[model samples]
Target: MKYFAVFFFVFISNVFFAQEKENGTLVNGIIKDDTTGNLLSGVNIINVNTVKGAISDDKGVFHLQAFANDTLHISLLGYKSIKVKVTNDWIKNKTTTIQLTQKAYALEEVVIRPYVLTGYLEIDAKLIPTRENYRYSISGLKEGYEAGEYSPNAFGRVLGSIFNPADMLYNFFGKKPKELRRLKEMKKDDTVKNLLASKFDRETISALLGVSKSEIAEIMERCNYSESFVKTANDLQIMDAISACYEEYKILKR
Candidate 1:
């Protein structure tokens, strides 16, 4: 009974130690350019044979967690690759500083002619008009050119058709004759004509027209229109467009 108890105690201790070993560890490090000593961001650090990895942040700091026995590989776009072994001591003391040496490249010096036309000299630069252009144009006319009595449902349906070509085709040719007839009747409504005549806010109009915001602003002011309409325009994702529109609108408003 005494010998059996000793064996069971040893077995339990072994299992605990095994579990502790499997828990692994984490190592934090920074990547820097060797030549300039500048911090390098987006350095790729991975295990040598395994798929585990982490990318350095904008501050060149990175933290990687893995088994203490695992090997690590580090690489940067313009730097030489490095492989390092993660030892038990290294795991216990977490932080590390990794400096990646930049790879030197040899370039054969050659002078090339400036007027080397490789392909077609005159490429077609004309913008190809898609169905989106037409839909937006109609939308612009309805929203900007005429704002009063805007049919949100009709406009939404037309916009939806531009996105869903299959749905548009189904609606045009499908067996729902009653729905098609109703849509035709709605299209010919007199209110639609009145709605199209209301002046749209310059910014909103420009967005719908897919014109430069500034350009539309200028057009509106020059035409003696109110900048008050600008409030209807949403925050645009395109920075350049927004900037240009704001600049032009300022000048035109002046």
Candidate 2:
């Protein structure tokens, strides 16, 4: 009878442990602005398949129960949305922090005028001299509008007829050029962040490079990850960057 009771107890305990494991993990993380490094609240975070989610509090902390197979989608207004892959570390720490980059707004041929020309006709206006007057006028001759020659003014008009003011502005400014340095990486989604947090956590990174756990902090610093790389690179590209950084660090140390 005692042996049967012991067997029943072990079975019940194993069943409970299996149930907990099957329930998956409760993942938690903080949200922040990549550019300003400020906490973001009220951000939406949801698991795509499960639809289980949470919103960040004033402190940017949030929690949601999710499985490793789940994809957590995070988003906010004026910022790009991100998808984070659930990982064991996320389940363990329950306090991962992620920075969301703000989206850049490009002005499309903006012409801001305080005064409304309500009555005026929205049309191009040009004054041209009569033929005889143009022939005698110094301004017309200097302008290459001489009567006997091909009307340079006619060509100018033709060019202006097809001209796009936006194109002209772009030409002057060189293709709406965005200064990469001036442009903060608020646009990058969370693929890289998730990669860093999941794949390069202290344990994983330490094992990958055979580094001691005590040196993980120094290893992270030595890698010298850039904001742009974090924001822009795809998974494979980020991995390459990490590998390169690790190699360089080894060379320097030796």
Candidate 3:
């Protein structure tokens, strides 16, 4: 009887351990194309709440750290973006399959302008119009530069941002405290950084930051980021800009 009791206790402990391991923190998933039923690879999977990111392999499989109530943003180049909310059932099940529908792209009309440039350097320069811009620096900030056009009110706007950093970034980072808090987590993930570094589009950043593209531009502008950087920088650069600006704002608040 003693031997039997010991065996039963050991068996129960093993069962409990197995159950715990089965319901782990990682969510395993396979992605496929809805129309063709073909496995899709290179899909971007991001846990927006945690700011953890992963990419689907050639086998169309991906694993990401997620939990109940957290949301996952899945996207690819040609497919429609999807948001999957993690549920208690999903946590228990531990595996899922997602299908993405292809996005219908409509081509817009394009007008091609023929540029007639003479062989002279001065004449070619005259053919292209250039806008003059200026950068202003504010004291007591780290790497702060206000970019503005060569206009009458440009200096005043830059001065306003320099003097009142909080007001400039309040609309961008104030209301989205939960999302902004994940900035550090985002910077820690090498996969997320690589994904952002290669992409020019702000889609992933927008989803992670919970802001629109226009809002992102506006926020960066108010934070004294140069217009050239705001318009031309990669997603990783934009992420760094937001992180720096938010850190400055936090320090200023204290």
Candidate 4:
């Protein structure tokens, strides 16, 4: 009876330790420039699965809560972004260092020709291309508009996302309520907004939201955003669109 009691106590203690490690722990990390070996500040660090974020201080040090296997996306303007995975070692050691490579751009020479006004309404109107934006809204849902490209099936797409219980948007955003809940938090952070504004690639947003690039494109399409906007808009614009769409989705489901 004494032996059995000792074994049971040991088993329970081991099980609790394993579960605590699996859930996660706070990890400390430092960011630096790969070429210069200097500490980089204001870098964005986000846990993709948890949607929890941290920014590197002036000393390029940051700390975040992360589980083993969780992906951490690190990004800074004018530098190539990189993702790092949290290993069991990282949780155990509790510290890591990441270095980012700066992006280079070549300047191209160009000749500029200024447009001259014809001073005639008909001639000027013909010379200048007109940009028209269209807005489409569903009957029962809140009012909103899709700008840039117009789709013939826009109504059907928006209606399906709202009315169909098993739609992709429903499954995608619904299953990850905690992740989507951080959209507002990301939007409110100026550092995040600035970083996203400079980036055209959907990597940061996709990683932060735990979605793939293809899935992001589909979500935009379903939300009635045009192909042109999805292709050209920066990550900040995409984040805003997703937030708006998610808000509407939450309202409709309620």
| Best-matching candidate per TM-score | 3
Model 1 local distance difference test score: 0.48
Quote each prediction's TM-score: 0.35, 0.38, 0.74, 0.65
Local accuracy of candidate 4 as per-residue lDDT tens digits, 111-165: 9977677999888888875644455442222664445224566455655776677
Off by over 4 Å in 4: 1-23, 109-117, 134-153, 160-201, 210-222, 226-234, 246-254
With a 3 Å backbone cut-off (N, CA, C), the pairs that clash in candidate 4 are none
Q: Report lDDT (Cα) of residue 169, candidate 4.
A: 86
State the C-alpha lDDT per candidate.
0.48, 0.50, 0.77, 0.79
As a whole number from 0 to 100, the lDDT of residue 79 in candidate 4 is: 93
Candidate 4 has a TM-score of 0.65
Ranking by TM-score: 3, 4, 2, 1
List candidate 2 stretches off by more than 4 Å: 1-19, 109-254
lDDT of 2: 0.50
User: In terms of lDDT, which candidate is strongest?
Assistant: 4
Query: On residues 45-92, what C-alpha lDDT tens digit does candidate 1 reach at each position?
Result: 754323345778998998776677776667665677677777777777
Clashes of 3: 0
* Residue 187 of model 3, lDDT score: 70
Question: Candidate 3 lDDT, tens digit per residue, 117-191?
Answer: 898998999998675555534322356344443346634544455456466465566678888888778878887
Tally clashing residue pairs in candidate 1: 7
